[model samples]
Target chain A: MIRKLCIIGVGLIGGSAARRARRFCEEIVGIDADPENLRRAETLGVIDQGCASLERGVAAADFVLIATPVGAIEPLFRALAPLWRPDCIYTDVGSTKGNVVEAALRVFGIVPPNFIPGHPIAGAERSGVEAADARLFEGKRVILTPLPESAPDALARVEAFWMHLGARVERMDVGHHDEVLAATSHLPHVLAFTLARMLGRKDEQAEIFRYAAGGFRDFTRIASSDPKMWLDICRANRGPLLELLGEYETALREVAGLVRSDDADGLYACFSEARAAREKFLKSTENNHA
Target chain B: MIRKLCIIGVGLIGGSAARRARRFCEEIVGIDADPENLRRAETLGVIDQGCASLERGVAAADFVLIATPVGAIEPLFRALAPLWRPDCIYTDVGSTKGNVVEAALRVFGIVPPNFIPGHPIAGAERSGVEAADARLFEGKRVILTPLPESAPDALARVEAFWMHLGARVERMDVGHHDEVLAATSHLPHVLAFTLARMLGRKDEQAEIFRYAAGGFRDFTRIASSDPKMWLDICRANRGPLLELLGEYETALREVAGLVRSDDADGLYACFSEARAAREKFLKSTENNHA
Candidate 1:
């Protein structure tokens, strides 16, 4: 029944969602704050129509997807709420759910029972619509955090929407989604960035980079992510992110102790166990479509 | 003047080195502990000839390269000492230089003037001769640690040998080499393995893996590395490895504090700084050519 979709902040996530949703719906419009982004999305045919301003573009769409940085989602939703059709559904493609959900609840006050929160767990080092592809979400897991008071019909429709785009959808409480993602996604990225920063602080940064082999390059590649965007993620998922970081540091210290003591056997055990676990994770995930 | 070369251990590194060294030398023979590996190298035409026995392989060769695991290098070098031609040059391809240097010196009262301790900074997650490619070393850095008493003539010959194989060789003291590599290569691998292990310890590893994005996959890809190989590396470089682990933990703890404090300003500063550093590192290393 949700045939027309308008996607806000048409960057990588928004553009990708628009492209993937094209197969399930007949129409898609994209809006972006940046004129260049709107122009690129239009040329790429990522959307049937594109607008530099959100208000002019998304006023009549059946569904509006807010896919911006963590800090911008609430403001975006509030701006679009006035134009939203009475029965039309609303959703998001944000990395942190709790903050965005709270922001939405604070701004919209339960008038729209059709609002659904979702996150498609798929992305690349690259960003923007220029880097977006329709197949980005195919075989990827998409987590939805619908409020308990959300209309069941609205949740089902949103779930069906993502499923049609080839994403396997799972629903969980928003708080739980924030905690799980904080551990698996946000914390790792923060650690990577921090490690890279420490190395770069040295006067011999050029030497360090020159000497970086495959391992160093891959380990810190995520460190090169967009600054403002990652800042937004860290701030939004602060509580759980801090908890996970403590756990990681504890494990690191334990390994460090074994190394300090010249406990070759202990170091070997830790490395072996870690390597085996990673192999198992990769093998188990191989069957996933994405 | 060095023409005939012999490489022990016909795995990825040995096979690739044989092919690359073949370009500079007229003939190269490879020896492997496993008959299957020797046979595969011969069948792949990676070597002019394959020797099932090391004694027969190094007896006639002017340059011998022990390209085995860190622990295996000492035993192989010791066994070859009896059969070693008086003026023959010897070298090794091990991850840890200090330990290998110590082992070699332990075997020979004085460090062999012709013994070159080297590690080529090139490899992939995949192993075995089948994965070897002739251009593997092209544009990659190769570090060499020559003892203070090492013969200049011997050092020159070894440097020329790797240069001919398309690596840009850099010289560093053994201790510094271990310290730098412990941070650039070893610690990152340890963290990767640990991350994977943490997930494996979880009750729903399958669920965790199902949602793993590209970030986790790439970050932990090296965790799929051979366990015995990593174990040897950890044991051999315990001192520097412990120091690097401590530094990494300290960095992680700082990020955790920012997260726990929910300080958006602090988080942004951290992310922005890291992002700039990573970009700078990448830009500087762009023209490394090795």
Candidate 2:
């Protein structure tokens, strides 16, 4: 059992981790720049104590979970470098892992053996500590990108911690994690944001949105996610995202050509293939949850 | 009250209309190309009678609702023209009004005064008679693009029919309806299909889909929609969809540049604006239901 667990940034992800860790840890501490969030986390029983100072929060904790947005990871790592504890298991729930690893290297000038980069593939459009749910990570996948310097014991402890919260644990290479996430998560967000922005900017924007059906609503639901967090992810994983975006644009052009030329066979083939792929995806995910 | 209602192409939309119209009509006759679908509709009580022959179906009907795919609307109209009833109030639930209008003009030499073109902005990824819901169009927007030749009584009757199914009816020009739907619905579907197709073709496709989270699932849910139906829509509304797609590509490039240049502020601005718009949209939709 973790003697003490400290979570940085008591937003949805951070507060959720703290809430779930309550059953596995002796005490939970939360640190946030916003006093309101810290208070809410403490009052909601998401944390045992709230701290404004990172050093104070991490003081005697045996586990530290950096659950801030991707942009804040580097600065937090820099601050934690001076208070680095080798006995503690450190992990993060950042969307992008390569950037987190780079931040660790840049901060300490050497990768910390206890620092394990992780990303919980779960979220909601809602934000803040009040939106945190103890069941947020239940049945979700938590990907850990461990570095060569990562201590085996620390990595195992982090994996066990996430499993305690009911998440399936998987290990992946940092670069591969970034690329896979760019395609699966980051790229989808970009497309959603772009579509919403484009349609929202039209002269007939109000009318357009009024007529939007259930499909449009579902297709653009990610556009309602936290912009700052998504922006950080976009910046951190620009390379893979741009590459995938280019490929997608090319595919769209081909489909457009099929539509323009009235190529029924080609259009049907493209759409059917996509539908088949999506059905397969849905079935696999359902089986996983089952 | 309508004495008899004839529904052509009794799939999800058609089946749903039949199910809801049961309360207002004395009898409902369903005509489908697929015998299995017709049998299912009959078994499910979505229709009172199932007819394989179009002539037999429309012979005694005072109301004819052509609920076929956009591609099939023209041929159906051609068949209906030879059996045209001046007393019958005819309408269709095709996706694209411009295409439907053109089809009517081509087949009947003029859009029959009783032929009102309509599109109900409500659907699910699931299709077919078995998936039809009686409440499918409840609280949904139905766009009616009535040509100048449309009889006022017929237009009013069509609007009343949709209202009876709990839909809000709005009249729009044929060209305007196509453009609005292209931005709100067609473009989003194309984006979803293209993204799914691109990622599904990847070498690490299995791994990519495995890592996809809820956002990705929701964002691409529409990709699982009926391929033939969507292909018909893409073909029928090619011009507006292509134009919007070009604009979308340019917007994506601008966002890509911001990401590549690490212009954090610009990226944040785009995402935040999109989020604001989406939130506003959610609020407006909620207010509409309220």
Candidate 3:
């Protein structure tokens, strides 16, 4: 029986998961390097016990969730590998998966069958335990990419846990998962960041900033996400991100060529197709259930 | 004394402007080709009266704003030129100013000194009269592109009108306005539409749609904006938008090449720098008095 839950990092996702798991789990312990975060999580009742040290948090744990930055995940798993109870199941809430799995293999000697790689496709630009809410995952999708060696029972438990928190869980191969997320998530981040960088100059920033209505704010909001976290994500998922970036460049260049040549018909056809596609996708969430 | 106001196209911006102008002007009449939109505006108390004909809307007005699409504005202005009242000031709320101003001059024998080119940098992606709100322009920036022959009083009155509705107004030359907006607004829209078009597929869309979270929704939300409007914008501002698209492609290609070469350090640096710039912009906005 997975009676106790130990969450490392205790930020938005970590604290939210802890709060949601409270209904099912008997004990929830949270660990964070930041003291203020630990205090906030404790105040929010995200965890029954808050630990400043990793060792203290991992003790008496049936499940361990490392919710640190992508770059830190490898070192974290390495540090906890020997200390982690053999019976304890481990998982992570990283945005990208292939790098995380590879990092785990490097740290822990033979991949643990109890380890289930997972990513909860939910977040806000404003992060931290302060922004944590139990409903963050409500009606959202959480993707789990389990290795063939991963124990089915362990995978089932993780899926059940996420489902209890109102998340729709789905499974995919690690390589395919990275590529899809690159198109949907990583490439978008790159575009937002690039555009924000181009426009964020000190000279033009005031004018650009003043002109930001709902569309600009909404479009570039993710560019304001945690720099360290995104840096780690880019470094880890560089391959797939680059592939999507190439695809994005091809599309942009084609439109640019059209615009340069004053091809109004071509431009109109492109925009029309995209607009139709966006409408269709937004109007349907039925595929999410499947 | 600008006691009466006339607004053309009674859609979101036109209807909202009519409602907000009521606070400053004694009477507001709206003209729309779509009878349903005009009727809806009348019922919503956004205007004092509705007219199906452009001449009827502009004939007895102190101030007339042609708030139609870029393509429609030229024809609307041409149709009303014969019936235009000499004392009545004319302006337009079109996205691209150079095209509209040139169109106005080519269509009208003599462009009125009171004609001001303006764009209120505020709107929701959701369009139509029903979505119009008087508070849409509140605390937003309204950019005016004044010609060399523009009447000083007329320009000031237009600025003051926007100010009275709680907007901060700025003035720029039409050519400069197009270039700036191309970088800050038009290019972003192009990128959003292109990304959506490239990634959107009938079979793969289901999974991509399912995996879409905060980042994807925020970045591509504008992709769902009206295609006809965007297509017109692309055609009208083709030169600057094409140049800006090239700049974006240059950045995208650099990142793509680094990713292809497995240069994790380069990718991390790029992501971090972009994120930092975005953070700085977000922080600066919080300090603005407006």
Candidate 4:
């Protein structure tokens, strides 16, 4: 059992983690740059106590889970390196794993044995502590990318920690995790944001928006997600994200070319192939769930 | 009340229209080239009687609503023109208004005064008559793009017909309707289809799809739409679709450059603008309904 847990950035991811881990941990302390979030987390009983300073927050923490934005991870890691507790296990819930892993190397001159990089593949557009729910991780996938120097027992403990919180835990190398997530999550988000901007800027914007049905609403739903957090993710996962974005942009340009030349057969083929692929993917996913 | 209404093409959109119009029409006759659709539509009670031939179907109808693929519209309109009934008002539920209007002119040397172009913006990823729901158009917007030759009385009757069936009826010119729909619907659908195909064809497709979560599912929901119908829409609305798709591709490329250059501020601006626009659009849409 965890004696004390420190969850930094007590927003959606952190607060939800605390709420779910509350059962296993004796005490969960929340920390954030924003005092409003800490107050709300306390009011919601998401944390046993709130701390404004990193020192006070980490004072009693036997396990540390840094849940801050991707850009803040390196700075937080740098600060925490000097305050390292040798017996404490360290993990994070950042979207991009490469940056966090690199931060550990930069701070310690070697990857810390206790530092485990984790990313929970679950979130809602409505964020912050008020939107926190204990059941957020229920049936969700949590990926842990452990360092080469990661202690076997510490890795096992983090894996068990997520599993106990009802997450379907999995492990991968840090680079692969970042690449996979860049393709699946980051690229799709950028496309949604671009499409929303396209229609939102028209002269007949009101009419266009008025006629946008369920399909449009669903397609652009992710365009309403937190921009600052998404921006940080894009910057943090630059390499894989740029590669994937270039590939997607090429695909879109080809489609636009087909439409431009009135190539009905070409357009049909692309759309048909896409429909088949989506069907195959969804079918396999549903079967896996079953 | 619509008396002896004849509806051609008993598919999802047509089938749903018939089901909803049942309460407002007397003796609704369903016609389709596919006998299986006719059978299922009959079993589902979406239509009163199934007619195999267009001659037999529109023989006793006071109103004729052509509900076929956009490519099939011209031929259907040509055939109906030769069998024209001056008193029986004619209309069609085609996705592209400009194409349907041009077809009407080509078939009869001029658009018939009885002919009206209408498009109900409601659909599901699932197609076929079996997926028909009476409430598909509940609180949905149905745009009418009537020709200059269209009789005022016929336009009024067509408007009343859809309005009676629980749709919020609106009017626009054929060109504007095509342009608006190209931006709001066709562009987004193409993006979803492209993204789905991109991820599905990747080597780590299984892993990528496994962690797609809510954003990816919602974004790609329209990728599951019937490909043939979507292809027809792309072909019919080529001009506006190509223009919008090109503009969107350019916008996407700019964002991709921002990510590649690690320009967090630029990426943040784009994402923030998109989020604000989506929020504004949804807010106004909800308020309009309220």
Superior by TM-score: candidate 1 or candidate 4: 4
Please write out the lDDT profile of model 1 over residues B1-290, one tens digit for every residue. Answer: 45788888888898899877776776788888888888899999898899877778887788988888887877887888888776788888888999998887798877788888999988887889998888998888899999988888878888888888888999988998888788778888888877777766762532566667888777788888876788788879988888777777777777777777777788788888888878877876687762
| Steric overlap count per candidate | 0, 0, 0, 0
Off by over 4 Å in 4: A203-206, B203-206
| Model 1 C-alpha lDDT per residue in residues A1-290, reported as the tens digit of each score | 45678888888888888887877777888888788888889999998888766776766677878788888877776787777776677888889988887787788876357888899998876889988888888889999988877889888888988887789999888887887787678877987888788777752543666777777777788887887888888888878777777777777777777767767788677777877777766776787753
Q: How well is each residue in B165-261 modelled by candidate 2, as lDDT tens digits? A: 9999999999999999999889888889888888888733346788888998999999998999998999999899889988998998888888888
User: What TM-score results for chain B when candidate 3 is compared with the true chain B?
Assistant: 0.94
Candidate closer to the true structure by lDDT (higher is better), 2 or 3: 2
How well is each residue in B1-290 modelled by candidate 4, as lDDT tens digits?
88898999888888888988988788899999898889888888999999988899999799888889988998888778768998998888888999888887788888888888899988888988888888888888899998777899999999998887788999998999999899889989999999888888883444577766778888888999888899999989999988888798789889988888888788889999899889877985795466
TM-score ranking, high to low: 2, 4, 1, 3
Q: For model 1, what is the alpha-carbon lDDT of residue B144? A: 93
lDDT of each: 0.81, 0.89, 0.81, 0.87
- Deviation (Å) of A214 in candidate 4: 0.6
Show the colliding residue pairs in model 4. none
Q: Hey, what RMSD does candidate 2 come out at?
A: 1.3
- Pairs in clash, predicted candidate 1: none
- The residue ranges of model 3 lying beyond 4 angstroms of the native Cα positions read A33-45, A50-56, A202-206, A286-290, B1-3, B23-26, B43-45, B108-111, B202-206, B261-269, B283-289
Looking at model 3, the pairs that clash are none
**TM accuracy, model 1:** 0.92
Residue-level error in angstroms, candidate 4, position A157: 0.6
